[model samples]
Target: MEEKKLNELTNEELLVLKKKSKSTKVINASIIGFCVGIAGYSLFVAGITWPTIFPLLLAVIAYKYLGKNEKAVDAELKSRNLS
Candidate 1:
């Protein structure tokens, strides 16, 4: 589907998008935190292993994805002159 241009979006739509973005950020951060905790537990309890590496990998990927997505949302909001 074609996304609406920022200029074409209504104020309410922009606000909704902003709110959704905030929720998404929280979800991503929670996931990253959980993964890090798992990684740390596995590292200490089981030594170097796939369980430790996998969660660490997942955390890195999630962090990167979150950063990229946030930049997009922030840019959109900035362009719209909305916090």
Candidate 2:
């Protein structure tokens, strides 16, 4: 049995991988947002009132921001390798 390497992927396979990675990122972002919002709402209801919504919103924003940073870093590394 042999293991397949990612760089050995065909153009079509690469495209599929790219699309899958994008969708996964979007889905993950959305899930994190929902969890944050819901947890915030719960906290507010529990009388932790003032800070609840702020924390939740910040969590969602931070998660997406970190994801974007990761993608940028990945792109930079790939470009450097190609050059």
Candidate 3:
């Protein structure tokens, strides 16, 4: 029973979860990267050079945060165990 959820899983299961989480993280980061690239190009076309960096930086931050699927899995596993 302790080896079911990601967190509670044995090391072997945890490793599998980590690998899957990495894939999801990469996909999310790619999506965010695509959106950011589009937005940057749009800003460049509009000649909005001065503040465009702000949104670009925001997109990067969002990308980083959104790529943390493993952390979510860990939390969920923990919560499931606690119950």
Candidate 4:
């Protein structure tokens, strides 16, 4: 699917995108927190091992996805001269 540029989005579309971006940010933070908790629990149960690192990896992926969404929102805001 073709993606529209931030500058090309209508105000209504921008509002939707903004809401989605905020939702994604919250979800990503939750994922990071959950992963950290899992990692800590794994460490306590199994010591420093591969399983302990897996959740950390997931957290990193979530963080990167979060950054991408945030950048899109920032671009939209910048295009609208709101930032």
For residues 4-53, what per-residue lDDT tens digits would candidate 3 score against the true structure? 44445665565567667767877777777776776778687876674656
Collision count for each candidate, in order: 0, 0, 0, 0
Candidate 4 local lDDT, 1-83, one digit each (tens): 12366667777777777777777777778989999999999999999999899999999988876677568767777777765
lDDT of each: 0.80, 0.58, 0.64, 0.79
Find the 10 residues in a row with the least total lDDT in model 2: 1-10
Worst 10 residues of 3 by lDDT: 1-10
Winning model by lDDT: 1
lDDT digits (tens) for residues 1-83 of candidate 1: 12446557677877787777778888999999999999999999999999999999999999987767457656777876787
**Against the true structure, what is each candidate's TM-score?**
0.78, 0.47, 0.51, 0.79
In candidate 4, stretches whose alpha carbon ends up further than 4 angstroms from where it belongs are 1-4
Q: Sort every candidate by TM-score, greatest first.
A: 4, 1, 3, 2
Q: What is the Cα-based TM-score of model 1? A: 0.78
lDDT of 2 by residue, 1-83 (tens): 01134445455654555556677677767767776777767786785654666667767676866466346434543644631
